[model samples]
Target: MQALKHILYFADGEFGPTQAFRRAVALAREHGARLTLMDVTIESGIGADLVKRFGLADDVQQSEQRLWALTHLAEDWVQGQPARLRVTIGTPFIEVIQAVLRDGHDLVIKPVRERPSSRGLFASTDMHLLRKCPCPVWVDREPEHAAPRQPAQPTDANADPRCIRVLAAVDATQPDSRQLNRTILDTAGAVAGRDDAALDVVHAWQAPFDGSLPGAGPVDHDVQLADVLGLLEREHAAALTALTADYRTRLNGGDTHLARGEPAATILAHADALASDLIVLATLSRPREPGLFIGTTAEDVLQGAQTSVLALKPEGFVSPVS
Candidate 1:
């Protein structure tokens, strides 16, 4: 529950650091954290080849000029605020990760471009950073202007302007479901407390089967299906209640939601419907066992959710005996 003191902002691409700059500044000012603005320059042969093939000038003056402009943009945003600015030249993803490790930054914020042309490269970089970053990464989507503005007057004290609404996605079918749920809720509560945001818990359950192909004739298929769904609903409700109880008093405003569908799809849909600013979830470190994965529902939510995401690794816990 420690306050985030150092934050690294990854700035590159057409977004030109505007969105990341604004978010870093806002969070730093609110928490009195130091901000480091970085613009990564790729020096690989492929990058040089691309520039040459694209007929970029030999002097490389234009690119350097653009970099200077970006640095100024960051500086202007941090004006009249306590913040530090940094600019680094290297592979975008690698440089960002190195900065996080070197500076001991608690959080890293970066803007995600929706559906980039080089999907393969984009996917590789995204997966690598998500899997390897030492600290939590907040991939900010939803353009800056699209974010909800602060209201003139406070309507509910429970709903703070700084309080971000988070929906934690959990799967009850896994053997470690209970432990995962607890970790996710605790992390979400800590973040909400830090930002003065509310926490909402969501658990999505679907039929046991994948349902990829039409089933053959079965005499009691409908009856059997109904029985299975009934059991699932009961278990899901119980799990949701238990998870909510752990942080009921700590949360400003909280609720539990249960839906029947694919975990990733249902969770994203609910987040959109609720206009959540972030989704907190626990990721599986061991895939061979019953648990989450790097490319599991949590990962999908991180890449697909319109809001920011906080993913916690599973460790430092012992399950209670039945």
Candidate 2:
């Protein structure tokens, strides 16, 4: 797999900025990528309003102070690493999207919000980048909170919490899912190999609750359902096996599951079951308006995933914002 060479790390309002920057730097060092840490500020917002209410003479001064602190913190964390610090004041999504497109960044890293991971709920900034950005976006959900020693997701006793496992989510239905699956598999496998971790490939299938029937079925609904599911499982399993046959040596006890349920729900459940550190999946990209075209599975999995996600757009994806 072609490793990412240019990474754009979006600073998350001083919340775990240091750790997020460090992660970007670490991944950059791993792939010889350039790390650019960027922080965005808004000219008018609640914070600005609060500052004005406090009789502060300058709103820009306050923003500068915040960015200044973040820069120092990041610099201190990455003393010997090669990284760049960037600060921009504008609308968050537009500035971030501009940064990614302008610099030709192949990967983006930012902190996930502090709120609980759930379906259909995302921070505005995060949702914007996920929907609009052209490259893979890695939302960093650090295991620790402000308090000491509270891991965000449980980790195995022997496994390193940073990235003990990488999960690749694939869809067996799409005609081009083969290529996407290969990308996700190879990328996830490489990352896992580097960390001596496990790779789990999960494919969720919505069996025909009301789907097209194969033919006239027997009266027993359970029997008919079983027959249909068995066929689907075979096909999905075959695809997964054929793809994974080459990486037998790299993956130790890796698993491929053909789950019968909603794609987003199944993926999330499997990731949680495996305690996956990172999820790798491909989104069906469209050129609709910036926030209007997020795929259902992509949006839900991203919103509810406990682990960080590396989301990829389709081969010929075009951003509507441009």
| Candidate with the greatest TM-score versus the true structure | 2
TM-scores across all candidates?
0.70, 0.83
- In candidate 2, the residue pairs with backbone N, CA or C atoms under 3 Å apart (3 or more residues apart, or in different chains) clash, namely 143-152
Query: For residues 170-248, could you state the per-residue lDDT of candidate 2 as single tens digits?
Result: 8755665677777777878877877788888887877655754556455766676777778888887787677777766
Error of 2 at 148 (Å): 6.3
Q: Model 2 segments beyond 4 Å from truth?
A: 15-18, 45-53, 57-59, 80-82, 116-122, 145-161, 209-225, 285-292
Q: Which runs in model 1 stand beyond 4 Å of their true positions? A: 14-17, 44-67, 79-82, 116-127, 144-164, 176-180, 190-198, 210-224, 249-254, 283-293, 315-322
RMSD of candidate 2 to the truth, in angstroms, is 4.9
Measured with C-alpha atoms, the lDDT of residue 29 in candidate 2 is: 64
- Model 2 Cα shift for residue 253 (angstroms): 3.5
For all candidates in order, the CA lDDT equals 0.63, 0.71
Write down the TM-score for model 2.
Answer: 0.83
RMSD of 1: 7.3
As a whole number from 0 to 100, the lDDT of residue 299 in candidate 2 is 81
